[model samples]
Each structure stands twice: as structure tokens, then as C-alpha cells.
Target: MHAPPSPLEAERSDGGSGSVRIGVLVPLTRPGWVEAGHHLLAGIELAGREVNDTGGIAGRPLELVVRDTAADPRKAAAAVDELARLGVAALAGEYHSVVARAAAARADALGLPFLCSSAVLDALTEQPTEWVARLSPPQSRGWRVYADFLLGAGHSRIAVAAQPSIYWASGTRVVRDHLAPRGGTVIELDMNALTPAAVCDALVDHRATALLLLVGHPEPAVSIVKAVRRDQRLAEVMMGAPAGQPEFAAWATSLGDDGAGIPFLRYLPERLGPLGARVERALRERLAGAPSFVAFEGYDTITVLADVLRSHGTDRARTAESWPRVAVQGSRGRIEFSRTPGISVWQWTGTPVHVVDRDPAEPGRFRILHAG
Candidate 1:
């Protein structure tokens, strides 16, 4: 979401008068990042359409050079270097914070002003390279929303179940800080691997009235939900991150009523403005009907980078100047950057938390239980 990804690319005007080559490192193999990459490419192509229709960057057609990292940090780092070796004027990369960080560090070392799609981990911004920027808010943002929502809803005690991984760990910290001032105490459950029942047991042991599931994938989350629902824990409500992706609903269709009213933190708003509309339409055409987080992330990442070229910096000196000023309106509501550590926003600025209960037999989905 950040307009200029310090972790992504730096540009050099081609000797020829009118062309620029941009490099993109995609999470082409991993299921989540792969979906993210596809939508991102689709978003770029759509932007490419607009640029071609007018003129091109500096008058020459813009060329997009892409590579697949398969979600591996080392591979992503290598791919970024390779793209730089091949000589791209600008660059953009995947949404995973760890992978994006590796890529960003390399870009910074090379003096490449890399653009990251959505990683928001605080470490990414810690070194202050000025080359990297993120568009997503941090876990603090999400925790703020959830804590406010919880206090407003009148829940006195809450427990958050999150992975010990750096990304989720950050989210947990945010949740705790927000809940402390109020009469609420957030118990952290660190688990190597857990089944649905184990999750329920943790929640039960803590005697939590609510649970915030902060994770980057949907499978473990799906398992947790099943156990909760199977046991019929009627007192608790569940909220989670968009990291579960829309596909999570498909996989957990069996949860029926329990999955009903799960909240998902979505990036794209329903009504996209002019530019946002075009990106949305292109994404729908490309995605068919898959309402995954990848589509929004992809659209936002590419659009932000393209906007940086058009409205902000194309050269490093200009980039440093323009990055702070650039903002892109796309499928993701006002895609931009945040000073965080991961390529994700839900970990920071809290998600809207949608319930995931969608009936497989029916085409529609379970309604939103709560907005925040």
C-alpha cells in the first residue's frame, strides 16, 4: 500500500528517450501470496492499460518484468537481486513481511528504492533506510479497534489467541496494551500447534468473553472455529484477520451456525472512487468470483507503485521527495504506507472482523456479526 516500496526498486531512465522497466517479485507459488501476486499482476496490467491509453512513462511504453519467489525469503531476496541485475527502473514485491523484508534489505543495500505491497512489521521501518515504506497499518491499529469494540460492547475480560511468530506476536502486544487501561486483561496463548478443542480449552481456561485470532493463514483458524462450534460454546463471539482470506469461508462451510457472524478485516471498500472502480472491475474480471484478500492486496500494491511513477518519484532523488506525498486510491481503501514491520494491515489497524459462516449449499454468505 505504500506508494514507494523502499524494499522493492530504484529506477534509472533508459538511454532511449521514452521507456522504463519495472521489476515485480511475486509470491507466485505460495497459496496465499500466490493469490496476492495474481491479483497484483492483474492490477498492474490494468494500470498499464491506463498508461498506454494516454502516453507512457516519459513517452516510452512501460515494461513490467516479473519474478516468482514462491514465498521463500531467500528465494525472494535472490529474485529481487536478479531483477535489479536485469536492470529495472523501479520495483515492487509480495505482501509477506519476512519475505518483503529480505527483499527490501537487499534493495536498500543496492540503493534500490523498493516498493513493498503490504508488509507492516516494525522492523521493516526500523533501519530507516528511506527505501522501504508500507501501506498497511500495524497490529496496534487492529487491537485499538478490537479493544474499543470490546469496551463498547461491555466485555470486561478478553483473551487473544495468536501465534508466537513475530507478526502475530506484534498483534498480541497491541491487543494487550489497548486492553490494559480498561478493566480488561488479555491472556496470551502461545501454542506450537493446536486443534480446535485445544483452542477451546485455552479459551475456557482463560475464561475469556471474546477472542482475537491474529494469524497469517486460515487453516489453523478454521480448526479453532470448528472446535469452538462443535463444543457449542454459546457465550463467546469470534473476530479474526483477513489473513484467513475469503477462501477460508469455503473451507469451513461445514461450521454452519458457529461460523456464522465471523468478522473479516477487508481492505477494499464496496464503493471505489473513479480509479478505484476501474481497478475493482479489472480485479473482478480477473478473479471471476473469488473474494480473497489477495485480490485487494494485489490491486492496491500495483496501483500504489504505478501512482508513484505518475504522481510522485520515478528517480531516487525524486522518489525520496515524492514518496511522502504520494497516495493511491484503489480497490484497497486509500492504499498507502505505515511505519510497521509486516506486509499486512490487520495486524495493526484492527480488522472489521466478519464471521466466516457461509453455507456451501447456498450461494450467499453469513452476515457480518459486528463491523469492528
Candidate 2:
């Protein structure tokens, strides 16, 4: 069996001699994301333990300096400064776009390498800095992928509901732009300004075949689905959301049968590899529940960091320079980074995203519609 994680003390600070410290930034107590933070931390700790057990980076054990972002931008920025003060070699693990943007700025100012674990905001990468990189695809590309799925599914008239945040707004624009040329009608709806009933009215007026949600939370997404299901005219309309992927349970429980046909993006595979299967089993047995995609992201972040440190040692400059060149076969898929214009620098362009939906026959299970 693999070894358990190091003591809590090790997570707070460096514990042993010859240990390379990597700062972990996660939201543990955010208003709606406490559970998400825990899952991400679980995956990070698991990978760190495995790295340490397998002779660490050049025989130096990997130490994670865990810090809670709390879904606050200022807190995330402060945490980066704090972790740097604690002598961490690199910064990793942030799920929120706002927090990731703040952490990335702080890490850049501190001259520390920061690898964003799951934040997808394009602005996070748009900043000109070699110190920042992301494991998730830009929201624009992710939205485009979803748009392609809609077109492939014969959804010509799609209603777009998006969060006010640029993270969602930019992606919404991509979807509209992609569909306009294909003779597909995209009616934009303000998620904050319009009630679910109003959105439903708009969808019906437009004769929309699908509703695309680009949001950061599950509330409005669920509310809209519940609203859509309540109307017979909208019953035939497909409701798809990218935000629901992270909070599948919340969506499923809140909407029940209403969530069956809806599709959302997620990174985890229905079936795991041998290593991933073992990790999942161990996490499930320990946590008394199944793991989520955040867990997989956390695991892979550490794995990539370990690989980078292994090849480049602890020199911050060399490590940052080598980030674009670093590649590892992570749990999700081939983990690699490349600089793309309009995307972020050193961003992981190969994130495995699949459109998943709840199976009507088996409510607990999911059905993958398309892999991108």
C-alpha cells in the first residue's frame, strides 16, 4: 500500500531536511466551495505523498505549504506572499479565477513560479509574466468546444446565459461568434438581471433548441434547469452548463430528473487508469466518499511540479524557464504547456474536457457525450 500523507505539521511547513517546499492555494471555507477545497487538497496531498515515497525530487522530499484562499482575492494574494515568506519553491492549486488572478500577480511580483491548478479565466493568463501557468484551458476555448458540441447535437437556436464576470462573458462571446457564422441564432440573456422565468420566456420567444450556461456557481444554473423543466414548451430544450461540472451533486440533488439531459464539462474519466483507480479507491476509503475532478487536478499539479523540480532542481529562474517545456503523463491525460496567443503563457493546452450528463436510468451515473 502507498504511504499516508505526512503529518499536518508538514503541510503547514517544511518538516524534514532536503525537502522542497511547494505552496498549495485552495479555497477551504468559501461560502459555497468548502467541499471543493477539501477534494482538491486531498488530490494534492495524495500526489505529494507518492512523490515523497518514490524518492522525491532528486531524493529531496516534496513539502506542500497549504494555504486557504477562502474564495477571496485579497486573501489569495496575501497567501502567496505568506507562502513565499515560508520559502516555498513554487505556488500551485487555485480553483477560482479571481483568486488565481490575484495569486498569479503576487507570485509574479515575488518572482516565484505559480502553476494554476484549475482557474480558466483568460485574463489570468493574458498578463505578461513567465512566473504564471495554468493546468486548465482558457474559458474561451472551453466555450468554443461546448459550442461545437451544441452544433454537433443539432442545436441551431441556442440561448446563452452567462455570469457577469469576464471569465464567463468572454466565453459567451466566443459561443455567439462561433454560432453566428453557422446560421445558428444565439440570444444572450443576463443571468444576474433576468429571473429564471424571464429567461424561459426569452428562450420560448426565440424558439431556442438549447440553453448554454457560462457561470461560476451552481445556483442559477440549477434554478434555470428547474425553471426549464417546469414548462412544457421548454421541455424539449436542452440545458447545458459548464459550471455544473464541478458541483454535479448539487445540480443533481437540486434538480433531480430535470438534470438528466443537461450536459456539463468535467475532466475525470468514467473509468480510471490503474494508478488513478488505486488513488480513487484509497481516497474513497479514507474520505468515505468518491473523489471529484478537483481531486484529480490537485494530484496532477503536484505530479507536474515534482517532475519539473526533478529535472531542473530548485533554481526558481531555471524552473520558470523550463515550465513551457515540461510535460508529464498525468491522471487526466497528457499534461503539457505551450504559449498560445490570446491564451495564457505556458498554459496547459491539453486538458481533457468531456461533456457529461446524468443518466436518466441510473441517476448516480454519468453519460459522456463528447470528449475535447
The prediction achieving the highest TM-score against the true structure is 2
Considering summed lDDT, which 10 consecutive residues are worst modelled in model 1? 344-353
TM-score of 1: 0.78
Off by over 4 Å in 1: 1-19, 216-218, 242-258, 290-294, 310-314, 327-372
Local accuracy by lDDT, each model: 0.58, 0.79
For residue 142, model 1's alpha carbon misses the true position, in angstroms, by: 3.5
Query: How many clashing residue pairs, candidate 1?
Result: 50
lDDT of 2: 0.79
Q: Could you tell me the C-alpha RMSD of candidate 2 in Å?
A: 3.7
Query: Once model 2 is optimally superposed onto the true structure by TM-score, how far is the C-alpha of residue 145 displaced, in angstroms?
Result: 1.3
Clash number by candidate, in order? 50, 0
lDDT of 2 by residue, 178-282 (tens): 888998888888887999899899998988999887655566777777788898888789888775453446556666777787787777765777878888886
Error of 1 at 139 (Å): 3.2
Candidate 1 lDDT tens digits, 1-372? 112332112332453345566777776565435556666566655565566557666566666667776767788778778877866766765667677778888877776767665565656644676666555544455446656766776766666667666777776676678778877787776556665577788777777777666654445766766666666663555544434443433444445455555554444443446765666666677667544544555556556666677765467556645556655565645444443444321122321233233443453554333344
